[model samples]
Target: MSTSLDTTRLLAALENVAVISTTDLQGNITYANDLFCKLTGYAREELIGQPHSIVRHPAVPKAVYKDMWDTIKAGDIWTGIIPNVGKGGGVYVVDTTVQPLRDAAGNIDSYISIRRVINDLMQNFEAVEFSKETFDEYYAN
Candidate 1:
């Protein structure tokens, strides 16, 4: 049992900080929350009907997306750390979860993605990778 007040507060908190978007089965953007639009630098009107791949970053391995799609298409939720490109080519990292929405007839209707920016974590990871690469290069030479 949940009170309306509790639900409203939770919704408000998520809306204020979370990047949320929904896409059709074909991967066209159907809905994007205010936070998502602000982060992506796209107006709601511009995003609608556009492929969700618009924000995909080249640095992210293709296998990552393939796994995500395979899992969600199988009606399972997919969670991963994704590097995305924002407007103006700014790179951002997000901890993302995508879930398939099913219709009443048991068909997949769409996908809903919830993402939280993880800039600090991503920076640390990048630094670690760079250090590893530099050390390997020096020792190999």
Candidate 2:
């Protein structure tokens, strides 16, 4: 296949699997692609104009978000694995990349986040952490 064909295929695959969103500089959600709404169990009307934190899980530490904000605000990209809470309190995990979009003046206009779920890997990690916690509690006596 030609390079252009390969790039097109890759982008199609990414669109199929990735959840994408854009937020204004102050963190209000501006747009959410269909996959994002489906995965989060929110309708487009419900998601638009809401804070991106609408999907945040408490299990994710505040410091992680702080780091993401700090990095993006400085015009750098931030990437990390994040735990998120979906509708009905369901949990999901995603490998996320946050990028700042700059306006013509070189100031940030908005931010785009692309995320892909890592289901089994994150579930296993959560299981291990649970086991560790259980073991610690048992040994504390």
Candidate 3:
């Protein structure tokens, strides 16, 4: 018989602590925790096998994700704060990291993104100014 420390429980534990969901190369959701569902307003069935971009918010500058994709595709870890729109059209923020998973041949086979809800610190004027300066430098604004 299997113990409580089975694969499912381990995954559940990871979900309990993880802030976001994990996806495959096709952007299909493979694992999503309760926090993810709550944050995105998406049910498990609605998210699994669905593209992660479904939660992309219009307010978010596309350049951010462009950088993220470039980094992850290069087999690097991407860390940033992302703006996402919920199913109800409500806006939210998350401090996110996208890490690439490699297969036996050391080829990237998937991506795992961990994210945690962040307060709207950008709503502050100073934060906005800092963001403008930083992003301007990053994207040559």
Residue 125 CA displacement from its true place in model 2, Å: 6.4
Question: What is the RMSD of candidate 2?
Answer: 6.7
Per-residue lDDT, model 3, residue 81, is 83
Predicted structure with the largest lDDT when compared to the true one: 2
Off by over 4 Å in 1: 1-6, 123-141
lDDT of each residue in 1-141, candidate 2, tens digit only: 544667778877877999999999999999998899889899999999999999999878899999999999999999999889888788888999999999999899999999998888765887869888999999998
Is 1 or 2 the stronger prediction by TM-score? Answer: 1
Query: What order do candidates take by lDDT, descending?
Result: 2, 1, 3
Best by TM-score: 1
User: Which candidate, 2 or 3, would have the higher TM-score against the true structure?
Assistant: 2
- Compared with the true structure, all predictions reach lDDT values of 0.91, 0.92, 0.84
Pairs that collide in candidate 2 are none
Candidate 1 lDDT tens digits, 1-141? 744568778988998988999999989999999998888888999999999999999878889989999999999999998889887788888999999999999999999999999887665887868988999999999
For residues 1-141, what per-residue lDDT tens digits would candidate 3 score against the true structure?
A: 755588878877877766667889877888877888987788988998988998998878888888988999999999998788889988888889999999999999999999877655656879878888999999984
Summed over model 1, clashes come to 0
